[model samples]
Target: MALWTMSFLLTGCVIKQHQSLSFCETASPIYISRDDVLTQETKRQILAHDVVGERVCGWGRSNHTS
Candidate 1:
């Protein structure tokens, strides 16, 4: 019974450590903008570029954070 309890505690600690490490390895969101007027074609071109994640765009807003 004591050995079983120790095993359970050790397993829990390992699982918690794995979870924390995975969270740390995760990437944060990225935001990009252009300085000139953006046309629909420009936006489409930007989206068509080689990438591996989602993209979101907003206009005339003042609540963005870096």
Candidate 2:
């Protein structure tokens, strides 16, 4: 009986994982105007955030759409 129940649980069970679960959104913007100057380290961090947002749960973006 226990084996039958376990089989049933395995057949249709799904694990939904969200990227945001792994990464939290930044409270402040990582980037500023294009005219603003950024240090190399800052640029790298921004790029990393952008790449993650593109492929992941769509975090790291402005609160509203442009």
Candidate 3:
């Protein structure tokens, strides 16, 4: 069907890159509290968020945060 074919074509792209970039543009970075515990999983998540933000939004480059 035409509807089904259109939907199929619309689904193709690099995995989550578009959505992730949009999130990087609009979403705020996660805040870490001095008193909060940093588990391994929590550390990994924080690292990933910063890395993605850096790559997509260029945060932390040349002393820029946004």
Best by TM-score: 3
Candidate 2 lDDT trough over 10 residues, lowest sum: 21-30
Count of clashing pairs, candidate 1:
0
Error of 3 at 41 (Å): 0.6
Relative to the unseen true structure, what is the Cα RMSD of model 3?
A: 9.0
- Of candidates 2 and 1, the better by lDDT: 2
Q: List per-prediction Cα lDDT, in the order shown.
A: 0.47, 0.63, 0.70
Off by over 4 Å in 1: 1-31, 34-36, 50-65
Backbone collisions counted per model: 0, 0, 0
Per-candidate Cα RMSD to the true structure, in Å, reads 9.0, 8.5, 9.0
How do the predictions measure up, each by TM-score? Answer: 0.25, 0.40, 0.50
Residue-level lDDT of model 2, residues 1-66, one tens digit each, is 999999989977877776562454443335567577989998788777666665565544532333
- Models sorted by TM-score, best on top: 3, 2, 1
Model 3, which residues run further than 4 Å from truth? Answer: 1-21, 61-66
- How does residue 53 of candidate 2 score in lDDT? 64
